[model samples]
Target chain A: MTAITVDRLHKTYLVPEREGGLRAAVGALVRRRRREVHAVTDVGFTIEPGEVVGFLGPNGAGKTTTLKMLSGLLHPTSGTATVLGHVPWERDRRYLGQMALIMGQRNQLQWDIPVLDSYKLNQAVFRIPDADFKARVEELSELLALEELLRKPVRNLSLGERMKCEIAGSLLHAPQVLFLDEPTIGLDVAMQRRIRSFVAEYNRRTGACVMLTSHYMADVEALCRRVIVIHHGRLLFDGALEELVHRFAGDKTINVELADEHPLDPAALGPLVDGHAVERSATGFSVRVPKAETPRVAARLLAGLPVSDLVIEEPPIESVIEQVFEATSAEVDGG
Target chain B: MTGERLDADWTSGPRQAPGEGGLAGLVRHDLRILRTYLSLGVLNLVQYRSDFVLSVVNAVITLATQVLGLSVVFGQTTDLAGWGPYDLLVLIGVHFLIGGVLGLVVRPSMEAMMEGIRLGTFDFTLVKPADSQLLASVQVVRPQALVDVLVGLGVVVFGMTRVQASLSVVDVVLSLLTLLCGLVVVYSFILALSTMAFWFVRLDNVLAIFQSLFGEAGRWPVTIFPGWLRIVLTFAVPVAFAVTVPSEALTGRLTYTSALSAAGLALLFFAASRWFWFFALRRYTGASA
Candidate 1:
């Protein structure tokens, strides 16, 4: 079943245009001007039950705006969206009870209260049965390793620990759909991996559809199979991560380690490959070439230079996604 | 689903949640908060024992000045505007009691709500499946104000005894009902004022206006004011309901028509306040695109 269906959603905000200085500020009080900011324009997507999808976008690309609309925290100016067959913006209690939105920068937990107390409050808010609430809390505690931290006040926990508790508290109701906006932001790699694994495991166990937005590609790489790329409030691409890479970035990076520190100019070897240039280093050089030309370039370089070690890798997903946005912008300019 | 089975699963009660729990649940939740606030209030008094002592002394001095003012007014005659010294003392007591309750939740919560809106924490209140007004009103309880409530009650009892008016069951019930009605009126008035925050996001001054008006008008009887000013205080701002009408009931000066009018106004204001809250919420979510 389609747990979430959004069709041509649009959200526009009337942002006041202000000038600098005290004089302008005083003038604005009398006669203010507002410019329309189309935060999300013609955005649309759907998520099936139990599917974990990653929403990728740049800053100010309306990712959070879209998530807010889906979670019922925001009302779109036009178009329609239904989560679990209920219009989100209507904010029906039954519909709210079946979904949750967790933002990394925003905390729902009471700062001075213990994590357990916050969970208990969630129990009341979500109307979770005591047995079910207890079971879910225990399971989340085990998964997030929150045994010792449950007694501590939320203010005392580290960022990662607080995030773990935040995620756990949000899940106390066992929501059928989860909206996560940069859930693993500002965490160390190890902490990010832990949270990513926990989210994956949670989805696996509960069969809840998860829609996550993050600038961190590693998070999407680890947890999401289907990726939706949005830029400037427009959907750029929606497909598997691998397909995104192949469709946007058809190049491979070759890093060659010479036998010795060769005093050879990188530009000297530029024409040897198909316009491939050595990126920078003393003992090693990195070259970027199209996927089909990688082998030819490597063969020519190996036969010509005193090569010792070489490694070929696909470009990082971040770069691929960046190229996708850049290509979209170019297309708009061309049109 | 059966009520018994639902009740068994929800350890708290058959109520959906703290806020969602119908009227009974709301009352229970509010009472629990009151208990916690009472404890915190005691703790705060102990922490600032010196301040409390000083404030109590200051209050006594203030009360002496009020009595002196009353005596000065009565020096010319036995009564001013048909209310004697003892009757006026009861008015002061009722004023303090009502002021104490408003201080406990209304004022602090208004300020807190403004701050919450500014900081985006109000979203937490909105997302919960509870009455947003109830959640916003009772989210924070100030315990220190209980001192005023106790002091007011003591003064009322002493003043009533001194007046030598026999307290009947009907009089007592009427006083309680009027007091409750006064509280509801004040709550509705404050809710309407705070709902303005949804539009005038930067107008923290609106609450300051309420505080200043309440502090000034709440101390004196509406009857003492001039005709136009009396109408403004009675009907426009409704400060009369907050103290005067209730105290009038206690002093046997309340009319059945006026009491019924106060009750009717209380109901009207409560419904308007609820409607305004939902309206503001709709605007908030809609405009926050």
Candidate 2:
């Protein structure tokens, strides 16, 4: 069964509007104005149980709005979504009990208490049986290496430590579906990798479906095989991670090394890949050409120039995602 | 990756997940969760033993100030507006009791929830499977306020000794029930105001006005106030219900209609505030960025 299925889900917000100054404020008191903000416009996607999918977008691209809706925290203006055979926005107790949403920026754990004490509060609220609570605590503590941190007050723990405890505390219920919104937003690279692996490990151990949003490319590269990319509240691409690169990262960089120990003239290299960006170097230049022009441009460069070595490479995933957003945002701006 | 499956049991009780049956079951589940939050607050307080001493000192000083305020008023006449000094002591006791109750869970939790909404952490509350109102109202508990609770009881019993009237079992029971209703009325008022933080976002000063009004106005006997104003307090704001109606029940002066009125207004206050909380919460979910 599908863990999550969202069809033509849409959200629009109406926010109060007013100009600055005393006169406008007085005017607003007489007649308030509102402007409609279309947060998510007819977005749709689905994920099967046990799959980890990356949710990608620029700021205000409705990534969070979609996640909020799927987790039952939001009611969309239109359309429908079900997570594990229950309509999410209905907020059935059984549904909430079976799913978890962990936003890295927010702390659900009680601040002044020991981490384990905070976990006990969750135990009481979620009403986990005693034996299960103990066993799951033991299992998660071991898996997360939280034994040392569990006894310390949450305020005393380091940021990374707090996040570890936070994740472990949230998973005490062992939910079937996990929505992680920017779960590794501000961690250092090593801690980010640690959390990424921990999430992957937890997902593997429980076979839970994980939908994650992260600004860090490494996080998506490590954990997400399939990705959904949205820009300006519209679905831009949804495919394999590599396919996203291949589809939107349309440029290929060809780095050339000169056979002769002499500087090459820029004017002489004008015939090949004329519209592309040909950045110069001491040995030889590197030119970024559209993927379609790579082979012909390479052949032309090989025949026309004094080249010792040439390497053709697709751009990094970070640049690829950036290109996807920039190109899509431009389209949005135009229309 | 470790492929070992977690022996997770979702169908099993955390304590027995809420929907077993009926209203009583739901209340029991919610009360247990409240106990968890309260005990956690106590455990957190243990980390700062000095705070307990400070609260004690503060409570005693506050009690002295109230006694002095009462003395100055009583010094002017043998009995002011037909209330013996000791009868008004019961009123004083109810004031501190309601104050203590408000400080303990109602005010702190409201402030915490307000800050949570402003900071976006209230999202954590909405995500919980429990009732949002229950979670928000008890999210932060101050153990220090229990000192006032104890002191308030001490004053009530002490005042009972000096009074010239006998309290029957029904009087005692009615007094306790009215007192509970009083607390509910005050809690509902504070919560309704706190919920306004959803729309206003910066309502830290909102409770100050209510606190001062409740503090200053609750100490006086409701009968001492003018007729129209007393009716308004008894039904509308319910500050009279907090400090007057209960003491009136305790001192053998409570009429059944007043007791019934207190009960009715308590229910009204609770229903109104509960409705207001969800109304604000809906806005919060829809409008939070």
**iRMS for all predictions?**
8.3, 2.8
| Candidate 1: pairs in clash | none
Give lDDT tens digits, candidate 2, residues B171-275: 889999999999999899889989999888899998898888898788888888999988877776778657888998877788889899889988999999999
| Highest-TM-score candidate | 2
Candidate 2 lDDT (Cα, whole model)?
0.85
Winning candidate number (DockQ): 2
Candidate 2 segments exceeding 4 Å error: A257-267, A272-275, A280-284, A302-309, B1-15, B18-24, B286-289
lDDT of 1 at A188: 90
Put down candidate 2 lDDT per residue, A248-284, tens digits, no spaces. 8888999999887866766777777675768888888
Q: Give the range where candidate 2 chain A is weakest over 10 consecutive residues by summed lDDT.
A: A262-271
User: What docking tier does model 2 reach?
Assistant: medium
- Report the alpha-carbon TM-score of model 2 versus the true structure: 0.94
Off by over 4 Å in 1: A112-116, A135-161, A188-190, A259-268, A280-282, A330-335, B1-78, B285-289
Quote the lDDT for A42 in model 2.
85
Cα DockQ of the candidate 1 complex: 0.23
| TM-score against truth, every candidate | 0.87, 0.94
